[model samples]
Target: MDMGNRDTIGRRILIVGGTTEARELAGLLVDAGYEVITSLAGRTDTPRFPAGIVRIGGFGGKEGLARYIRENCIDLLVDATHPFAAQISANCVAAAADADVPLIRLERPAWKKPEGATWIEVGTAQDAADALPRGARVLLTVGRQELGPFLAYTGCHYTARMIEVPAGLPDDWRVIAARGPFTLEDELHLMQERGITHLVTKNSGGTQVAGKLEAAVQLSIPIIVIKRPRLPKANAVDSVVWAHQSVTRIFRTG
Candidate 1:
């Protein structure tokens, strides 16, 4: 039986992931009958997985990841890390070249202005904080790293949201310990429960936390969206569905 154009080589792929796109990609690869393994940074408290061979934690460094590549016979490498994760992306670039592996990056697109959504742009975390009104109840969707800057902004109450809360968040901060892919009803309720008048988030383009955005618009709360850096030069996809199509295009060598 002729298996027309199908490569005899079953792809041995390693996905470096710590984001929503990574999880979704891993699941899709498994269903596609590809030999896949996923690596997580283990940064979140309870990261939800989409099912496949999962490895939690780092690869030590480029040398370490290269070793794993050679040892496991990794044929393709996909870096689907967060936009802020410059270090990992650099390492992946170097290691893949050294190991002689083909690499692709799954970069989610940054947010664009939408009608009815008023976005105030800011360069830094402090700049975003300065744009907010004093003593106003704010829904802070900007992760934990940047929240410390706003700690000294007096009188303003905050509903600080993170995958996990740190030990030292200011007493004035009201912490919400939860992960995202959040629902509109949930975000709306949070806004209502806390009397939130402002929303602060990065221009992270995915629709996971977009519920809060809708809630902000409906309530007439201003949104402060910190812009993301330019994407590193590499093959990229903006969403899970598009990423699936990308892999489907990988040519099969007889």
Candidate 2:
């Protein structure tokens, strides 16, 4: 798609991505005739690939990532990773600083509690588990990787929502194997059918699966929200469109 425009071509960008915003930003970069490479953390069994060139797996750590940035001639680094992926984001901040590469974050804003929803905000999954009341019928949508701390709360029965169910789940827990963009009707029905009294979820904000929050509000169900981690200071934007504009400005000025 390179149109032979000097301003739009030959610039190399690396997007540390795994979220919807990352995928959308990658497509925008490719359409603008820039060389784009997207990196996934490889935690998921089958991750969805973005529009442009894709690379899976970790870069070892900060030093290895810095070396990669040096070797690849990357002009910019865009971190559009998940809000809960604090370690990777921290590494990116360190690596970019070490390699002297400019970095920008395309982070989506956290969800606010809708009116009528009883929300209990906590700092982490462990804190959420601790705050959960005894014998509550819980809907756990915080993903399988963060289930360890919740497992200690045997008093509550959990209904986990995941892309794939894990083997040997606790006797008190069950899985609803699903992916999102769930309708409010579907979410409400699921909550009713499961008799879920409480929900435990991360505040990874986006429109994709926000129906659950709305459903919780409608049903008078309480939600335990794990707050996003405090990331290292960096240049950041909340929307993909603005991030695209920023990229174009960088290329034009260079």
CA-lDDT, candidates in order: 0.81, 0.89
Q: Write the per-residue lDDT of candidate 1 for residues 29-88, one digit (tens) a residue.
A: 888887678898888768777566778998889899998888777778899988767788
Residue 223, candidate 1: alpha-carbon lDDT? 91
Give model 1's TM-score versus the native structure.
Answer: 0.87
Best-matching candidate per TM-score: 2
Q: Alpha-carbon error at 247 in model 2, in Å?
A: 0.7
- State residue 204's C-alpha deviation in candidate 2, in Å: 0.5
Stretches off by above 4 angstroms in model 2 are 1-8
lDDT by residue (tens digit), candidate 2, 50-96: 88888898999988888888878788999999988888899899999
TM-score of every prediction relative to native: 0.87, 0.94
- Candidate 1: clashing residue pairs, number: 0
Worst 10 residues of 1 by lDDT: 1-10
